[model samples]
Target chain A: EDQVTQSPEALRLQEGESSSLNCSYTVSGLRGLFWYRQDPGKGPEFLFTLYSAGEEKEKERLKATLTKKESFLHITAPKPEDSATYLCAVQEAKSSYKLIFGSGTRLLVRP
Target chain B: SAVISQKPSRDICQRGTSLTIQCQVDSQVTMMFWYRQQPGQSLTLIATANQGSEATYESGFVIDKFPISRPNLTFSTLTVSNMSPEDSSIYLCSVEDTREQYFGPGTRLTVT
Candidate 1:
């Protein structure tokens, strides 16, 4: 069974505060890991796709890093607009692109 | 990347009724998928919408309850039959071009 767990279900950070959200996964075979941002009542928007361990990607103030057993989404000096539910998903190597997603970490950036 | 458009952004339906959600992609796609998300929960895959074959449903989901149709490479529809309060959720349509998948805006369903 493939499972994904995220830490800090909810976090409230003041503006310019930095924090990192964790996504720990256990799968039969690792293919790829994905990160997304979803707003209220909307579907997830694509973020970064991590293919292998020790890989990192960044966009603006958001940076994502991948490890052997987990992935981290780091928010550096986040703005109010960056507040949303950040989701982590893992796709198994043998499966046909079906993703198992984490419960997600809700980030609230207060300005 | 594919751009997916889902119709009827939301709806309020009575119990035992049915609702069909449509997804149209801007370009050709090899695979289409449906997902369900309950309030404050993670997304669960419902089925794979194959163009020329019957859909493959995930565990706990059946074709009798949720039927899917993929008429072509860029279009598909998912119908939720015999709606209930438990069925009220966010239904999302996704298309996979290669290794990555893109999602629709989502349909928010509220069953009474």
Candidate 2:
């Protein structure tokens, strides 16, 4: 069965702190790995998509790196406004666009 | 790139009642998807709505329980039947273009 596991169910970091969230997945083959940020009482916002092993993508303060079996989302100098639940999902080789998501890591940044 | 919008941002309904959530995209999209996000949980795909075909439901979801309609390439609706406390969740609609997807704001449903 294809499954996704995310570590550190909840995380707290002070403003300007940097950390990384991990997502390990078990599947036949990883077609694509996605990262999304979701705010409370709203929908998920798109972040980045990594397609192959050794691939990495970055946005202002967020960087996502992928490997054969796991992906990491690294936050650099995160601010309180960047606090939200970060979700990691993967698309299996057989499925075209359907996604299997991890439970997600809730991050809180205090100022 | 697409901008998806959903209607009835939030609602409170009595048990056994039904509610319909609508999704609209600015540009025509090839596929639209409906998802359910329970409190503190990851998004669960409910169904995939195509332009001129029956919606394909995922495991644990049924057509009778959750009806979906895609009359055009840019619009769709998902109706939750027989609401229960478990049905209290945020329903989101997403549109796909190639590989990237854009999501709507979502509709918050509370069953009491």
Candidate 3:
């Protein structure tokens, strides 16, 4: 069975604090790993997609790195606006455009 | 990136009533999906809306309970039938383009 697990169910960080959220997965064949940020009462917003084990992607204050068994979303000097639930999902190579999502890590960056 | 929009941002319905949510994408997408999120829970895919064909439902979801319609490439609808308090959730629609998926704002449904 393909499964995705995200650790640190909830995190409270002061403004400008740096932190990393973890996502571990078990799948038949890894096709793609996705990162999304969802605000309260809204749907998720697309962040990054990592396809290979050694791949990494970055935005302004966010960086995502991938490994064979896990993935990390590193937040640098996060602001209160960065507070949101971060979601991780994986696509199985054998599946047809379907994503298996993790429980997600709720982040709060207090100012 | 594609921009997706959903109608009826939020609604409160009585038990046994039904509600339909609409999703519209800015551009034509090859794949579209519907998902449900309970309070503080992660997303659960309900079905894949395929244009010109019947929607493919997930394991726990059924066509009779959640009917989906994909009449074109950029628009789709998801109807929650026989609503109950358990059906209160945020329903989201996503479009897959290339290898990335973009989501809409979502419809917040409150069943009472």
In the order shown, the candidates' Cα RMSDs to the true structure are 0.8, 1.0, 0.9
The lowest-lDDT stretch of 10 consecutive residues in candidate 2 chain A is A91-100
Clashing pairs in 2: none
TM-score of each: 0.98, 0.97, 0.98
- In Å, residue A110's CA in model 3 sits off its true spot by 2.0
How much is B94 displaced in model 3, in angstroms?
Answer: 0.3
Which regions of candidate 3 fall more than 4 Å away from where they truly are?
none
Q: Give lDDT tens digits, candidate 1, residues B16-108.
A: 999999999999887999999998898999999998999999999999999999999999999999999999999999987667878899999
- Candidate 2 lDDT over A1-111, as tens digits, reads 999999899999999999999999998988899999998888889999999999999999999999999999999999999999999999888878788889999999999
Which candidate number has the best DockQ? 3
| Model 2: CAPRI class | medium
lDDT of 2 by residue, B1-112 (tens): 6888899999999999999999989998998999999987899899999999999999999998999999999899999999999999999999877687668999999999
- TM-scores for chain B, in order? 0.98, 0.98, 0.98
Task: Order the numbered candidates by DockQ, best leading.
Answer: 3, 1, 2
- Summed backbone clashes in each candidate are 0, 0, 0
